[model samples]
Target: MARKSGKMRSFNVAVVGLSGTEKDKGQAGVGKSCLCNRFMAALADDYSIDHISVLSQTDFSGRVVNNDHFLYWGEVTKTSEDGIEFLFQVIEQTEFIDDATFQPFKGSKMEPYAKRCSATKITSAEKLMYICKNQLGIEREYEQKLLPDGKISIDGFLCVFDVSSVPSRTIEKQVEAVLTILNNLIKTKKPIVLVTTKNDDANETYVKEAEKLVGRKEYKGAIMLVETSAHENINVDVAFIVLAQLIDRSRGRARVLPFIEAARVR
Candidate 1:
């Protein structure tokens, strides 16, 4: 349900994680695309060759707003106006259009990243999915560019992992990395949601594994675990809805401005 109002806030949401982590890796057929489509409120059933390397944009009319589009990176980033332009220019200069080996689950999701690392393709040193700066512009720009990534601040994270795969150190690493950035680099306590994909594959054994995996840690806000299957359309909307709320909550949050405090002393 969309909020009925003339006013709305534009926020950027991104999907991120390391490769070979989706639904048993090398087994699932592009869960990222399916999840992205669902999260962005779109539907697609086929794989695309062009999706490899270059980022994809989709418009999502969120409950509070329209034109609430999301930018996806097989990895992710956050940037300012200046940083975003650099991202777009880099993409233009080094289009990821080449052959490469991707060891993860085979499909469109892995292709863009694979293409990015191709021998001939110039790759970005940092892993970031850029949300265009003009998105936060006054009115807007006809053309939008990606941000440089590394130093920009992110609002939230949606990490997708398979329920059937347990003892997933990879998933742990992914969570730690995002939390590390939010806590240390970005210095904001961003929200994180762990999405358990391929719910249909869950059995008694798998469910126990999933529970144990979730039990192992403490998270900010809440331990958000959403099970989804784009194939079955199970919890797909719920997962993203939770993500939206997290982003909203993040925006409503306020942090102490130490820099301002220091400047005040001067």
Candidate 2:
């Protein structure tokens, strides 16, 4: 999708926890700082995605976007809400291309094939706009769904997992919950790419447990586990390439390498 043309300084993507090496000792899962760092590294190239600013939980001096939403990770506080909300705030502030110009694919490729389904045929991108607004709790208007540029509709969400740091028990439960969420969100048979970040910080035991979790899931075939690091500037590009593939797929362009390729592995 094209970017909106305007004099707006820049879009805001709050990499809440990904900008530093710090971690809350009490938290059990992957560190927010690490995740934010990796996420930013992966998405920085996209003109649509921007790192506006980070608001630390300890010190929140009103760095919220558009004076409404606060981008945050870790735990919810008065300063910020939740991880999902943090993402939505960024989306709300960003602008997309002309909302009226999108040409919905009309070919048979847009038809149901095998298990996958097609995009919405409704001329208006209302359904997606509603989900993005309400599901993420952006607190925007029911009518203000479309941005000035009109491309707020998201085809699907790509969840990047840091399996190596997730506790075994928590990992199992989170995986199940994620699968359920994805199954529901993609009810139209949309694709949800669940890619795993490469974690050298995790020990062998954690890796084994993550592999086991991957094995137990029905979506195992599409899961990709990468061992990369943003600090080292590791296979970060691969994630964006995968994201590009997803964008192409959304446009009815099928990719030959359906599986994780060797280049992205190392």
Candidate 3:
């Protein structure tokens, strides 16, 4: 049995999102960039982040290269034991658009017709799933087999999706995929935090869909809904602090003494 009493256990979390301009001019949206920036800021006290690596097609190699944010330790090479081990740890702290895929540059481009690239129609969820399966050695079919390593099994997953960029044709399925992943993950009895990556009212539809999914089903794990935006620094701190508390509680670690209210600052 994994010892679930270590308040001192350090965690290496990866906040995967888009970077670079719509067509690779190296400009990212305020919402996507801020989501991660704020998350790091909030966790700076309890945990130390190495560097925020901007993950893209160019940096997916199995090399420990320095990056502006965290060290961009490219894709996990199957041939290298060290690479696999490092990626496995990252997978543990990862919070992405979808529980299954990562495509960091899909929506960053201003217009799809611009660069005239291969034009791969990849959704945020599919992109993230690709990273997990190809880079992290985690496949949906084999996740169960990969579990039982004596670790707390991801403690929980917090997926932040910027629904505004979702394409019209596949939006419904994209949303459904998230619900499915959440339902499956909750079975582990770990807390799942579904965060809206944008604060605009335009995203209310997406938030509502997520809420419906959680409320319609009786999940074994705790579910939380938060609206996060990095530019204005809206609920970034609130989301992270909330997750930290959830993580602490789930691991059966520290608990606030009686009558000491857990501060809920907006």
Candidate 4:
């Protein structure tokens, strides 16, 4: 359930990806961190595409090369024409471990590999819910009163793929990873958005191939497909806003304006 405070509604979205390793040559990293950083930076200041620093290929590949996860909070105070405001708290996770064996990844600058494989594991829907309730502090009041009440913890998911790496089998594996977690782990309907990152270097052939894959029956559950470029700030904000709107719609709430219109009005 959404935690509401006055006109603002808070949502927890999981930004999932398969971070590329050194083996994938010529393919920039999945760009999940870059996208999250760009969005959060926009939230903190004016939404300028050029203000944020760009991560070089070496830095992008080296940073977040492991299975570490991060949490980012952003608010879209821009009231829609319908007067709806949204607060989006996103968790950027590259792996999905089982709920029973989930442990938070603890890595530091001095010891980047400390407890890496042991701590960083994949997460299931149940595990994500557990993190939302216990770690992210989304619904403290509700949890205190109704501790065991059944409710979907995560509002939506942003399954990210590297558009530049779409030709590789890694894209298929990434898609399968998400489907495996969603279909086998916890059987609940949650909104999913297919996000292809690094669109600035997007290959038309690769992009078309990814679109074809998303059109398959297995990926029919994804409500939207956003092509984004975190380095160029292309559709970064729109991706989150669209997912937020879809989450609201999934819960049978009044629909908000499209991200373009809402952004313009703001």
**Candidate that scores best on lDDT:** 4
* Alpha carbon lDDT of each predicted model: 0.38, 0.33, 0.37, 0.49
lDDT by residue (1-266, candidate 3, tens digit) is 12337433432223322223233212223243345544444343422223223454443322211111222111221111112111222221221121124333333433322121111121121122122223332234422222113222244445554545443324465455455555455555545566666554336576566566556657633677666655445565455445544655543322221111212332
Which residues of candidate 4, in runs, are more than 4 Å off? 1-7, 24-27, 43-68, 72-83, 95-152, 165-186, 250-266
Rank the models by TM-score, top first.
4, 3, 1, 2
> Compared with the true structure, what per-residue lDDT tens digits does model 1 show for residues 1-266?
22226423333344543343232233333245556544443235332213333222221111111121123332222232122210111111112211232222232334343222221212232323333322322213322223344222344555555544444334455344334322331233455566666665544554444445446554333546676665565665555555555656532222212222423433
- Residue 248: error of model 3 in Å? 2.0
| Residue 132's lDDT in candidate 3 | 21
lDDT for model 3? 0.37
**Runs with alpha carbons beyond 4 Å of true place in candidate 1:** 1-7, 20-30, 41-153, 164-188, 249-266
lDDT of 2 by residue, 41-100 (tens): 324441121232232321122222222222222111111111111122122111111123
RMSD of 2: 15.3
The predicted structure with the larger lDDT, 1 or 2, is 1
- TM-scores of all candidate predictions against the true structure: 0.45, 0.41, 0.46, 0.55
Ranking by lDDT: 4, 1, 3, 2
- For this target, which candidate reaches the highest TM-score against the unseen true structure? 4
Off by over 4 Å in 2: 1-151, 165-169, 212-217, 249-266
| Model 4 score (lDDT) | 0.49
